[model samples]
Target: MGKALIAGVMRWQNTLDLTMSPGNVVAKPLEHVIAANDANKFIAYNNIPPDIPKIKTKSNSKANKNKC
Candidate 1:
């Protein structure tokens, strides 16, 4: 009975090791490469001119004009 218990414990340990092994970890660099490629494609397809001027306005101008 003791020998059977030891064998069962060893088998369970092996199973745990297999399930938690680092060799089963996913490759992160491959994911980064895929993300960068996707970003490049997205930027290429959605290109907008960079020289456009942005509108800037003061918020209190309307209240000051109303008081005048």
Candidate 2:
């Protein structure tokens, strides 16, 4: 397995344990960093840019307007 994949797996396991145990506020930042690095590594290896889906908001103006 690649370094990134290994790192990711380790971080995931750590995060899971932390979540299950509770009260590890001090480790949250490090956990986040690990997760972010894992994501970056995966993205780099896949050679695909991250695609964040856009949220579509519905406008109520048309439906709320008084009909003349």
Q: How many residue pairs clash in each candidate?
A: 0, 0
Tens-digit per-residue lDDT, 1-68, candidate 2: 11222463554322235444335674464455446454553332222235745444453223565659
TM-score of each: 0.14, 0.19
Best by lDDT: 2
**Which candidate has the highest TM-score of all?**
2
Go through the candidates in order and give each one's C-alpha lDDT. Answer: 0.36, 0.43
Candidate 2, 27: how far from true, in Å? 2.7
Candidate 2 structure, TM-score to reference? 0.19
Residue pairs in steric clash, candidate 2? none
Q: How much is the lDDT of residue 65 in candidate 2?
A: 55
Candidate 1, 30: how far from true, in Å? 1.3
